[model samples]
Target chain A: MTGIFFDAVTLSFGKRKIFDNVTLKFDCRKIFGVTGANGSGKSTLLKLAGKILHPDSGTVNFPDNAQIAALSPEMKIYDALTAVENLKFFARLRGKILSDEKIFELGRRTGLDMKTFGNERTENFSTGMRQRLKFAILLAVDADIWLLDEPTANLDDTGRENFFAEIQAAKSEKIILLATNDVAEAQICDEIIRLPM
Target chain B: MKLFGSRCDCVLAIVRKDFLLNLRRRATFAAMMMFALTTVASLSLSTGGAILDEKFLAAILWVVIFFAATAGLSGTFDDEAQAGTLSTLKLYGDAQAILFGKMFVSMLSLLALTIFILPIFCVLFDVNVEKIFLLLATILFGLIGLAAAGTLTAALTTSAKIKGGLFAILLFPVTLPIFLPAIRLTEISFTSAQVDSSLLVVIGAFDTILILASSILYDYL
Candidate 1:
């Protein structure tokens, strides 16, 4: 009933079945990679865990007191807000009032330029920069579980290296549920589950 | 428990973010103000420079508020969805808090619109409001009902393909009850008619029901 769990879960839409009687558990302090081809329900799996989707006949349970952060390309940053403002917004959502210096420091660690981050809205940032900025906020959250869907999509080499380094550091105390197709990314996970297409 | 505090923070965060976003764009505010002004002007000109009756003026005022509020507030969730921040807010905190926060923002926007339009309306129509305080109370209550029902309708139509059109269609029927009492109260305020306590009660009850329903329904949404 704690950490993250799927208990004989079934998910479907209309007559189409996505996951059939799937059971899995993701523990704390480990990286979990959900690898599958297109239409293989990797994202769906994470959605079930994140409580964004309900299973037809079973349950997905996460800790009651745990703080969760979900990151995806579809997860948007406010276009009118500066990067630091966005970070502060997310921090406030989690009930933490972070200082601007701390926010900028987190962005810097994620390879964002502090100058542009402080002045410019994220609407004008490059795709890599946006992804890095979002990831930086996720890191700053220090959540108990992070649901990341294709988190490295638009990251450049340096950004990817920084993310991998951050994940490596955080894996000792956080639970990371990652959904990606890249073998390199999958290789870093402590456990990997490849869903059937 | 700290739960209440956290939820309050979440609501304030949403309200602040939406106000700033709308302030920067000014699109909805401008649209509502323009629509209100245009409606008032057209109505003033249509009588061939003759004075219109208080009942007709009351009807026209409610119509303007309805259309302008619909235009301004229907995109509550749609804008968030387009900006890709709905998922973030949905994931981060309580959905009910988001609903209340959105309703609060809608109310604030409508209040601003009312403040900007009432003076222009009085001047253009050449009608001195006999009961200004009563009219203000009526408008305030009407706006609360509008915000509650409109915000709930916005949530319902968030996933619709024909968003704005569908939102308007769905909103009209749900808000009719509130509009009736509001228009009656406004008409009374414009003339020497006696005040009706029951109408005010009806509007207040409508607001309470709509807000409670929206709060409960948002979880399923």
Candidate 2:
């Protein structure tokens, strides 16, 4: 009841069946790795859990008041807004007003120095910087469920260390789903759900 | 009461973010302003000192407003989609709040355009407005209707391959109800100085229906 449940979930894209009669329950407070090859429904599974996509049949259930946040490569930050502004705007959307100090703390947790680059518009940011900002946004929302697809794709070595540390720190009370193909990343998960190609 | 408060916060946040983006980009507002100014100036020059009839003038005014609204407002959702932020909004923001916030921004843009163009239109065309209050009311209602219709059309077409073209095509047909009544009301204001209560009611009703429909349809999209 407190975590995500998929009951007889069958989802298809046109004629190709992505999830065929799949039933899985994610009810733990540890990080779960959804590992699969390219085009193997890794991201699709996370999206289904996030309710961004609906199953063609069956049901995916989570608590009614559970807050969910997703970070995918397809997601983007506002180009014209500064990094701090972006974090504040996203937090506000979820009815939370984030102070500058809180935003700075989130930034620091993601290996980003708010005092240095917080005021610059994100359009000028590099790929790694944008990825770090996305992580900061993920932290700012402070959701109960986190659906992170390819979470470390564009992060540098330092950024990855910071990300893993944060994940390890927050794994006690949150259900974190990490969809990745990297063996090292998958090793960090307590349970690995491998999707068949 | 708590739900209502949260909804208001979401709406306000969306409006604030959009306004800031528009201010920074300056593309949509600039395009709308340029389209309105160019059309009005061209019509004024082409008239060649001839005293245009009130009905024709009213028609011209509405035509300018209509096309300008189309040119600028159709990108409301297209911009978000193109920038890859539409999904983010869908994930975090409430459906009704997003619809209302975008509609409110469109309304503000149209109101600003009307203020900028009305005096120039009146002076260049040498048209004496008999009822200023009625004219403003008619314009206000017409713009609200336009904003509502445009916002819905933008949302409906955000996923289209040719979003801008589809937006214009769909908007014209969908907004006919608002345009016809609005044009008539403007003419009444200009010529007879008599208000058509029924026409105002029609436009208001259209606005309400469009806003409600958009709020419902947005979640599915």
Candidate 3:
């Protein structure tokens, strides 16, 4: 009741049935790795938990007051906004007022040189920089649930390390459903749920 | 305890973000202004020094505003969809906040376009607006109606394959209520200089209903 639960969930895209009568429950204070093949609905499962997608039948339920944050290839920050501005704007959306120092700290944790690029618009950022900006947003919102789909796709080695460390530090208090194919990433999860069972 | 966030703050944040993005890109505002100017200039030249009827001119004014709005404001949600920021907004933003925020931005853009074009239209056509205040009120209510309709259309068509075409198709019929009353009000402003309070009420009521309906329906979309 205090976590995410899927009850006999069935979802299909057109004629292809991706999920059929699947039930799973994820408790808090744990990092759950959702692993599967390319078409195995790893990301789809995370989307369901994040409430970005609804199952055609059955139900996906979570706490009423839970705040959800998602980082996926399909999620992007405003290209015209500066990194700091993006953080501030998103925080405001979640009713959180972030200070300049706190924002810079999030930037630092994500291995972004926010002091140098904070004022610069994100359209000029490189791919890895944009990914870091997304991570910064993920941290800024401070959500109860994090649905990360391929969270390390564009990060460099150091960026990946910082991401893991952040996830490890926050794992004790949040319900994080990480969808990834990386063996190393999956190994860190408290439990790994393989898709297409 | 407010778990998610304050709805009012979320709406304000969305409005601020959209305005900032528009300011930086200058796409929507610029497109609206360009279309308005081009249409007015074309009308001025095509008239060939002939005196146009006030009622016809009133129709032309609303037509120009309507099309320019269609061209510019139809992409309100498409911008988020294309940029892939829609999911994030859905994750953190309240549904009513998103709708109102977008509607506010659309109204502001239309207001700016009107302010920029009206002077030029009046000068080029050599038309003296006898009841300027009434004309302004009509434009204001008409714009609110247009913005409400346009924002809802954008949200509805954001997922369509042929978004532009569908948006125009749907927006035209949906906004006819606003346009009919707006055209009549404009004509009265120019000729009789009398308040057609009934038409004003119609446009105002339509705007309110559309906005309230959009707020309830946006969450589903």
Q: How would you encode candidate 2's per-residue C-alpha lDDT over B14-73 as one tens digit per residue? A: 889998998999989989889999999999999897988878898899899988988889
Each candidate's interface RMSD:
1.1, 0.7, 0.8
Candidate DockQ scores, in order: 0.79, 0.85, 0.88
TM-score of chain B of each: 0.96, 0.95, 0.95
Candidate 1 chain B, run of 10 with poorest lDDT? B159-168
Stretches > 4 Å off in candidate 3? B1-5
- Model 2 chain B: ten consecutive residues of lowest lDDT: B159-168
| Reproduced native contacts, each prediction | 0.77, 0.77, 0.89
Q: Positional deviation of A196 in candidate 2, in angstroms?
A: 1.3
Clashing pairs in 3: none
User: In model 3, what lDDT does residue B165 have?
Assistant: 78
Distance from true position, residue A114, model 3, in Å?
1.2
Tell how far residue A178 is off in model 2, in angstroms.
0.7
Candidate ranking under DockQ, highest first, comes to 3, 2, 1
Q: lDDT of each prediction vs. the true structure? A: 0.86, 0.88, 0.88
DockQ for the candidate 2 complex? 0.85
